[model samples]
Target: MTAPLIGDAVRAPYDLLAWLIGLWSDALAAVGDAFGIGMLDYVFMHHAFLVGGLIAVMAPLVGTFLVHRQMALIGDALAHTAFAGVAVGLFVNSLLGTGISPYVTAVVVAMLAALAIELISEITDAYNDVSMAIVLSTGFALGAVLISLNTGGLAVGINQYLFGNLATVSRENAALLVVLFLVVSIVVTVTYKQLLYVTFDETAARVAGLNVPWYNRLMTTLTAMVVVGAMQIMGVILVAAMLVVPVAAAAQVARGFREALLASVVLAEIAVIVGITLSYRYEATAGGTIVLVAVAVYVGMVLAGKLQSRRDVVEESGAVTGGMDATAGGSAED
Candidate 1:
């Protein structure tokens, strides 16, 4: 078997993305030379930053909706399926002589798994955690079996997929991440209101003339894209954290849904930038480092939220007591 024709179809975009990456690299190299930033001096680090920044944006963009809709686990399910897809791609390449990118296969399998999640929910007349759990398990099991079947040389490379590595970031894969970012951002921007409506209330969205099921499918598909894109740096085990932690942190401080969305993006970007920098400084795993940073951010946000709530309560109590005292004083004067 050969690489899919879709590879040919996307070759032009890949070329364009490569060109953009070159420009970015040149810019980063100049800045690094000026500021003595060692990391920006390397091409792999450039690609790592590029891919990580894009993942930070899209993961939380879709994740806001997922967290609000209580579907955050869907990222995990799709990510596991994507892992299976990676195994499939590697298996094919090993058995045959194709040069297919595992990320490509991961995207396809993950999207299909996304649809399968919706289908399972529909057949059962509700969004079902049990079904999602089954999908997650099955996908992982499939990937494990496939990996065992090709254990001769595949195990050596599998760690990159399982734990992720910054050094493995390649130009072609970065370009693919760019494509996924554009698709996810554009779709979400175009249908922001519809998704917001559905996330809050499917029955209300349907009553207001929206195709709830169709939107559900769209959300899951976007999630699948985000999961695979982030998997490049975050890995299958940690990708879902990118989809939930930032959003949850934002929700702690945001007063409204839109605010939560914007805050999530800002927080995610912070986590990525800080995480990547720290990972480079200490030579830590990118995925684990990023997740740790994100969770730390979440804990900070939670503490801030609690403090704000306490302050509000104190203010309210003082205002009420003052009003009562003023009334009593006025009655005495009367």
Candidate 2:
């Protein structure tokens, strides 16, 4: 009886977690049904929306640091590398009858690619972009070659991976996105100060006795994880847009680094929700739609920032003119 009770206690949290997930899933289904949207009627659409929302938050959260460090293109490089990983997984599965998920392979490959980029930069005294270019070209070339072989006949839906499709998001992938989001959020929260210090000034951080190399690796690793998570929906070509656009838009008007980070998340969330809705209505590509929305938001922010600056300048000019007129009037009266 004691052993049974202990087992039950150990299982209680897991049971509760399952119950909550079920509840949320049902709730989302109900909302979809109520909306009477054709696309939302399918469970895959729900998964896409959920995954999109999660990526919206995670991308910008990580992107804030990436943007500050001038490593924005690293996202693109990692994404292409993840594409190679996907190809490898598909090839292996087809050839050896392995049942591994492509995403698992993608994560592994992307992390390796990221480490390689860092290593090359560290060892050869090369610029970060140069290293990234080398990795990007090699990864994409491998992916293309593997895809061209196509001996496994697994290239049937390769377009979906390259361009993304709304129906391609499965429940399993959505769950994976949730896990990635939690991991990224926790890591960022825990390492916020150190990351901030390193982002602004790596030399200063090193001078202060911080482990700069470790944090650099950590940042790149986190970026790779994010790239793989996002690849399911954003596809190979446009996935990096999510990682950079929102942060750039937020930087246009943000008062500080933290503010930019928070604002970027908000902007990304808006873009995701709107883009998903629009894609559903039009039966369009989810990845392209989301990226288009993000780009629109970025342009809007840029325009708004310009207008605000102009207004500030005009206000200052008016104040100066008013002061000059007052001074001239006072002198004449005296």
Candidate 3:
């Protein structure tokens, strides 16, 4: 039987790396500590503030097409599949004593999963929902098995991925996240016209000679990057909320894709700020708190929509009554 990677002295480099990560995380936490806060407090406040803000900014930029194309569930699928990939990476690193990097493994595996989803959807005449169901169920099951095989305490790691431990993020991880966000931002903005054209009408886009396949793959790859990066902060279980909630909220009022993107970024930023504050006050998970904030925003928007509908009805009724009065006056004059 293979030994545990978590405590393996032979994997000295792994320990060194992990320790370095911990030190950086502490350093970041200490920045907030300067303000008289504890490590956890700092993470809960500043880390969430940073990660949530980044997600809010990017999600809307991509999520406009995702929502328009009815692929919000794709984010959920990728999140869960990435969880399995992380577990597998951990298990393999433990079993092989290779001091493998779980973060790198997660990105590779998740990218493969994204490709698989695309392939299955395109290749089979079968329903996309069925394909998603098969992939999601299998992915979760595999992840559970991998977790069980790990001699080290996989539960805590898994929990961290599922519910998020934003307070414990390392500087390297945060830096990596920032870099990924910048890359995604650049690609999306540079190819904005092509992406929007393809999003609204793929056939037309293709007929116009846009490289639909290449763009599709590029979009999925960008999504994979976002998912992998977010897994560290939001956990796999709730990360999808970041991608979905902002776009949904923006959709309620936004007219065009550009407007929706702007609205999503703004609402997402608000949700993150509100969520972080609430989580700090209630001693809750940062991921869960952020998700809750987004949900609350959506609910408020829905209520607003209902009220607007009622107002429109009243306005229409008054307009009809006024029109009838004008006709009656004209008849009396005749």
Candidate 4:
């Protein structure tokens, strides 16, 4: 319930993000008022959109690298661990009567899990699925145990996180998501080239003197952050879809890495916006609805990609046949 956020600089980021949310919410409220939109009248709707939109952008941004590097499962792994992180936060608060945010604790634990993945990869010289599976299993099991131990009333509250609830998007949580978005965006922007090189070609990056392990750690840690942020709306079970589905859709149509990344962000934003509107109108679960909408988008993208490929093939055949016919006619005239 109490997701306290970061250390020392906490108050400043929270205030800044909260102010930004307030600014956007006010504008949205104005638009709603002008149009008489029912959902926009609610503060929770504003926060839900704020958080969901940010998650939509950053999930694919980070996911592009992960998916290309075949690390899609890392998002899922970290999400499960983040669930455990939520449990840890709740357990500590109840057992010791502290008021720390479960989200803050989730961030801490997920980052540790990120580090553990990196270390295992570095030591074993392979980033395999087995390790991700184990980390995910351990984290979820630990969370289940902790929640059971403190089953007085903690279990009831875990459902929002397990499956996500849009109405639970508090202003504080919205602010926290803003902070995460900034951190992820800034870090990725600054280290874009290095991460790109490391992602596409680790050996060349190492030969060019890039610290591969550091970038790997950074990528996973970012994934952890994105997972937890999106978990507020997408829930742990489906949050990873935001990371993978849009990126996959983009990949189907995009020819280059950056193109795919940009396209993924666009596709994801569309999914989030449409998903939110539909969920609101139909009284459905936001997480599941958004994901279903995303999958539909993905299927559309796949069909388009197939058509594009077929068009290219037909064009090539026509070009070759025309070349052959022209050559035959020229020889006959000679």
Candidate 5:
């Protein structure tokens, strides 16, 4: 009887182990299959990566200066202003029923708005931040009113524009974003030195014949171009996170301007790539996830900075003690 009971107990455990193994195997296979499909769906899959990379690079390119100049809020305003353009585009497309590209129209209108804001600031001699605030509120209010009037067509697009939905990004939008990213990259590269000079010291750059106002306008235009491209990928709502957060994180770690720019780009790229991957798996909005990743990185960087500061203090104390000991030894020998 005892022998029979022990044999039955062993068989029961073996059966249970086999069942668990099969279940785990099936689960892993399902995940693998999904991953395989994602890999094969390159056309759709590549859209996020392409757009993400463009925004990642461009945001940091402009954002480093925006942070340095303490114009982070202006970046926020410009993003909202771009929303009005998107709304107007939706309205026009609905009324005319033509092949109107809302994003292209949005970019053009946003550029004009940026130009107008710059002109207003120059003429009124008002605070630029205040000027940006006025433009942001005005543009968003205009967009909100238009959206209310054309509730059906404009409303759907506006909601997505404000919060962003990367999974819904269309092919046309992706292609246009690619073109804009290339254009912005070339322009920034060509004017890099002038931008850096003006960003550091506008008065000195102006006296040295760097055309400060022109560079300022050029920078704004670049920001607009990036904003338009990013609007599709990250949407107007979270795109500014890419602009400011990565740079802020990078600033904590980097020493020189070039290093900061490179670090910011890397952080931005990491955020987008990882965020989108996780979002795709979890069925979340890619843009929001990307911004969240950026926030996490920023927080981690702050903590790292604090730790580094502590380490530096420890090292400095050790160096001072060693120097004093060496001086005492020399005096004793004398």
Candidate 6:
């Protein structure tokens, strides 16, 4: 009886999962039928859209702090390192039949690479960019060599990692993205105030008795996690764009730090949805399409900012002229 009870307990979660999946599928189908759109017709398309939406929120969430700290290029650096990790996973699987997923290796390697970047900066007193450059070069070099050695094996699906394909997202990978999104969201929420302090003024945070180094490490680790998760849809080359572009566009119109963070997430979601729709309609690369949409949003924001500034200046000038005329007329009457 105890054995049977234990088995039932283990199976309960699986039963719930199946029920949730069924409910979600039914909802998706009903929406599709009503709207006459085929976006969720296939399982892979559903996974792609789910993961893309998660990336939209996670990327810009981390990106807001990265932009403030001027560490925008760390995304690109970690992405290259993740590419190398993927290469290693592929090579090892091909050589030893380990049956490991490249994405697993990517997360591990990217986390290690993130630590290495911080260590190198601390030990050598190098600039963040310098550390990033060293890691980026070495990582890409190793990936290229590994791919060359296992050309017949790794070359087959390598393009999907280099340039994302919405159709290639599997259910397992989408589940991983969901886990990553939850983890990132929770960590950021818990550490929001501390991170804000460190971001704006690390020295002041340290003076206020904060563990500056720990927060720095935490930030980089989170960035690596975000990179690995986003790499599924954004690819190695363009994943960094999601991190930087949305934050930049948000900065143009945001009046404060918190506003920028929220605006960036909103902008990223817009870019992701539009980009995914366009990619599906035209059969284009999802990563490139998303980045291009982000760039267009940035340009629009810039134009709006400039126009707003000009209007403010004109209004201020008219106010000053009106006050001067009123003062002069009052003096003349006196």
Candidate 2 per-residue lDDT, tens place, 174-292, comes to 65567788899999999999999999999999999899989989999999999988888889898899999999999998878989999999999999889988988888888899999
lDDT of 3 by residue, 1-334 (tens): 1233234553674555546545645776776567765534544345456666787787767777777777777777777788888888778766776665566677787788878777787788566566667777777888888888774666666677777776656554565566677888999999999999988999999999999877877777777778877777678888888888888987776656788788888988888878877777788888888888898998877777677767878888967668756754545332
Score each candidate by Cα lDDT.
Answer: 0.90, 0.85, 0.75, 0.90, 0.78, 0.87
Q: What would you estimate as the lDDT of candidate 6?
A: 0.87
Residues 172-231, model 6: lDDT tens digits: 566567678889999999999999999999999999999988998999999999999999
Off by over 4 Å in 6: 1-22, 314-334
Superior candidate under lDDT, 3 versus 5: 5
- At residue 66, give the lDDT of candidate 3: 76
Name the runs in model 2 displaced over 4 angstroms: 1-21, 33-39, 313-334
Tell me the alpha-carbon RMSD of every candidate. 5.2, 7.1, 8.3, 5.1, 16.5, 6.5
Pairs that clash in candidate 5: none
Q: List the residue pairs that clash in candidate 2.
A: none
Q: Arrange candidates by TM-score, descending.
A: 1, 4, 6, 2, 5, 3
Worst 10 residues of 2 by lDDT: 1-10
Off by over 4 Å in 4: 1-9, 316-334
The TM-score obtained by model 3 is 0.79
Question: What are the runs in model 3 whose C-alpha is more than 4 Å off?
Answer: 1-44, 306-334
Cα distance off (Å), candidate 2, residue 175 = 1.5
Clashes of 2: 0
Q: Write the number of the candidate with greater TM-score, choosing between 5 and 6.
A: 6
**Number of clashing residue pairs in every model?**
0, 0, 0, 3, 0, 0
Model 2 lDDT at residue 274? 92
Model 6 vs. true fold: TM: 0.89
Residues 1-334 of candidate 4: C-alpha lDDT, one tens digit per residue: 4444445667776677778889999988998999999899988999988888899899999999999999999999999999999999999989898888888889999999988888877788765687898889999999999999989789998998899999888888887788899999999999989999999999999999999988989999999999999999999999899999999999999988889999999999999999999999999999999999999999999999999989888788867767756754545332
Pairs clashing in candidate 3?
none
Task: Give the TM-scores of the predictions, in the order they appear.
Answer: 0.92, 0.87, 0.79, 0.91, 0.82, 0.89
In Å, residue 217's CA in model 6 sits off its true spot by: 0.7
State the lDDT of candidate 5 residue by residue for 40-80, as single tens digits: 25445555566677789988988888788777876677788
